[model samples]
Structures are given as C-alpha cells and as structure tokens.
Target: MQRFLIALCCLLCSLPAAAWNGAGHRLVAVIAWQQLSAPTRAFVSAALADHPDHSRWVERAGGHGAAAIFAEAATWADSIRNDPRYYDAGRGEPTPPIGGRFDSRRQRHWHYVDLDATGRPVKGELDRQVERLSRLLGTADAPDEITYALPWLAHLVADLHQPLHVGRSDDDGGTRFTVENPFSKRLPFLSLHAYWDELPGPSSLRGRRLQREAARLLSEHRPPAQGDVDLWREESRHLHASAYPHQAGSLLPIVDEAFQRQARATAERRLSEAGYRLGRLLEARLRHRVSRETP
Candidate 1:
C-alpha cells in the first residue's frame, strides 16, 4: 500500500502543475459560474451554503462573493486529500462514511480513470460519481447531499477533458517520460505529463484574471461537436496517441517550439470545451429540475 501511494504521488508529479490542478479546476468553475443563469446560480449558492467548508470559504473568499466561494469549492474534492479531518476516524482512511448510501469513500479516484497500455480497462471513479450525482440530483435530494456531490461533478467534468486524465501513458501515465524543455536554461528531467499539465501556462493563471481568460476562450471557441463523456474520453485517447510528445531519439521528451504551440493550443481548446460543456450540463440539470417541478 505504501509503495502504491508513493507511485501515485510520483505519477501525479509527472503531470503538469496546472492540468486539472488547482488553477485548471478553478478556471472551469469560474467559467461555469459566470454562465449559469441567475436562478441556477442562486440554487447552487444556497446548496453550497451548507458545505462543511462554508466558514473557511468565507474566510478565504473575503469580499469575493458567492462566485468565489463556488470557484474555490470546485477544488474541495482535491483539497480533502490532505485533510485528515475528512478521514474516517476508525479506519483512518481519507474516505469518511457519511450517513448516506453513496460510496463517499475514496475521494481521490473521483478525479480520473486510467487505462493500461494493453488497452485493458481500469475502473475510474469519475463515471461512477457522474451516475451517482445524477441520481442525487434527479431525486431532488437535500441541498446537503447535492452540496457534497456538486463539487465532484464540476471537477470531474473538467478532469474528463484533460488528455492525460483519459489517455494511457507508457510510463505510468507518462510519469516516467522525462522532458527536454524548450527553455534553454532548463534541464531534460521534467516528465511529459508534467509538461502538458502546465499547458495553460503558469500557476499565476489562477488569479482574479482567470475569469477573463475563460471568457476570452469562450468567445474564441465553441463547445466541441461530439461532447458526450465517452466521446470526450476518446478525444483524449487520440491526443495521447498522436498529440502528446513527438519522439526524436531522445530518452526524454524534448519539447520544441512547434510541439509546444500545438500542445498548448490543444490544452487551451480543451479548457474552453470543458467550460462550455460544464455550463451546459449544469444548465440542463436545472432545466430538467424545473420541468419536473412545473407539473
């Protein structure tokens, strides 16, 4: 178990600092938060008021308002990973058993599913969480339940768009594939996954201007035509096979200018697509609820 965890961290490190990382997740949430109708925004904000982190959110958000709270909440699923308070007291696992029937256990895997090089399937938590979230919302469950599930839904939708999340890496999701960075001063030790993870650029991208970036991207692009979850995964798979890194006899991935531009473009496009889809998904869910309640 210890070895498994060590490898997981190493693999995670191989990913870029921003790919489905804090900045990326925040960007997705901000985008969705911006586009949600006033009614949907009100509903989500009210549901989120019951979150265990509401006090902390208030502290962190300061005067940023509910949108900031909602954006930060998008990262809660990832944040719980470090907080032992969320862990089961007796079992000492990160997943604490809520009174609910849902397998609120194993919060980490909710972000992604990985496949092997041989094309054998590995169970990912994202699909399971999506279905669970649907049922939770469909039944018109309490806000507390929706609050618990909503973060996962928002986050997983963004994670679903990260090519590395869906694509199989030869080196444990490319945690092993080292990179020769384009920056002349840098060494060739960074992993390919790490390189792609920063596709949106730096961690600084997660600031007050993230909304502007998301808005600009939205203005520039349209939602992908084939936008189903399954198709999204397949698109990632195609990128994994063809778009990730170009091999040129180097033991590590040596990213050239051309490759960097193409890869960055792909990542940017995916972020736009993710934001659009997440907004649409939330809007559709709200519409569904309204339709159901209208009778």
Candidate 2:
C-alpha cells in the first residue's frame, strides 16, 4: 500500500472535495439517526465504538452527544482522505491484519462512480463497494469488518444520492466544468461539482443549526421509499441533466439566484431521501444481528 494518500491527494489537488462536504454528510447522518429504532441506534453506536478512528471522531465532536458522534462517524470516510495513518490500497499486497484486525486502507474511489455515455461505470466503485461492504457488515463473525464498513456505508449511501457522484466521465463528474458564484466571496470560482457539493450548506454546520436543517429537509421531503443501491444511483444519474446551469453570455457558467435556489432545493430533497434510505437499510441489515446478539 502507498503510505501517503496518493490518489486522493492527486484528486483533491485537481478536483473538488468529496460528493458532499462534512455538513451534507452529517445532515444525512442526523436525519437517519432520528429515524432509526432504539435498538438499531444502540447497535450502530456500539459498532462505531469499536472503530479505530472512534477516538478521533469523539475529539472532533467536541463534547457533543451520541447524535454528534454518529454524525461525525458519517464523515469519517471523507476525513481519512488526508489522514497519515491510512494509506492508498494500491496494487500492493492486501493490507495485513494487525492483531487480527482488518486493515484501514483508504478506498477513496468508494465515494462516486463515473459513468460512460451508455451509463456503464467507466471508473470508481460506489455501488459495488456499498453492496460488498453491506454484505460484510451483514456477516455473523466479522467484528472488525463491521467496524470498518459502518462508516463507509454511512458515507457512501449519502454519496450515491449526489447527482454528480453518478455523473458522466466526459467531464469527470463536472469537475472539469468551471463555474463562477458571486454570492459567496469565499468560493468565487469552483467546479460545477464543487458548487453542488456545497449546496446542502456549510461544512462547519453542527449543533442546533444542523438539527434545524435536518428537520426542515425531513419536513419538506417525506421519507422516501427504501430504494435499492442501484436504484438510488440511477435516480442521481437521472438528475444530472438539470444539475448543470445553462451558461449565459459568458465563457464560464455563472450560478444565478434562480439556479442556486433550484440546486439547493434539489440537494435538500436528495439529502432527506438518502437519510431515510440509510436508516431503513441499517435497520434491515443490523436489526437481525442485534436481535440475535442482544436480549
């Protein structure tokens, strides 16, 4: 394995960040957390408690409750993109087990899939990885794998809902298409993908504001049906047509108020749907295990 975050670093230098920023992922997490049954939430909390980066999540949460911890856990997959302890799982030997524990290689490609014009995945492994990880989590005797997979499942379920995560390979999910946004001075110019990533809200979102945002989204968008992973990705792919803004009389596309409003609305609805789907998925996958193991 490459010691540094090689591929992720290269992608970060050239492209925008993950499918959703920290806030978007956390919002989805909180929304899901709100919907989960008590047993499932307990099981989720216990599984995450065994994670290697659990301490890091606690520290980052900064004296928050279990909800905050779960929310932070949702972003762990993205947070490790730059962490030194995790390395890229290159074509090297499989990461060896340490003390009989599963390895923690950073599989950054798990966040998105690049599709060809025919909708075949040209690159990335979002759907397949989620399915593979879900199976691993469902197994009876894989504590280490469950610990590892929980965070990834939390992150990827939300990612597959992002339109550009299922985007075309021609522009690398719109990362090649630059856009200008005069509304925010901090981000005047960025890729269309990055602009969509930030539409759910600021990366620093947390506490009451995060709760309010999640509540608002859940209220506006009713709990979506429990769609399969492939179905979720297809839904996102269908939304790609409207994800990009029409370029006005300028060389670069500028995000106008109307487009931003529409994008934000779409993003919030997607986030709500992802949250409910994740909650239902976790309940189905983990409830049986919890019932068998617990009283």
Residue-level lDDT of model 2, residues 1-295, one tens digit each, is 2412432343356565477999999999999898888888888888889876788888877777788889999998888776666677774455445335756577878888999998999989999988887777778486767877888899999999999988789998888776767777876667888888888888999888888888888888888878798899899999988898885524457788888888888999999999998888888888778897655
Model 2 vs truth, CA RMSD: 5.7
Instruction: At residue 249, give the lDDT of candidate 2.
Output: 22
Clashes found in each candidate (C-alpha, N, C closer than 3 A): 5, 0
1-295: candidate 1 lDDT, tens digit per residue: 6534543454455543223667677777877787788778877777677666767766655566777777777777776665655663346644544433334443555666667776543745555566567567656555566777777788788877888766463455555666666553443346676666666655545446776777787888876673566677767767786555665524344577788778878888888787777777777776665444333
Prediction 1 TM-score vs. true: 0.80
**TM per model?**
0.80, 0.90
RMSD of each: 5.5, 5.7
lDDT minimum window of 10 residues, candidate 2: 1-10
- Candidate 2: where is the Cα deviation over 4 Å? 1-17, 91-100
Pairs with backbone N, CA or C atoms under 3 Å apart (clashes), candidate 2:
none
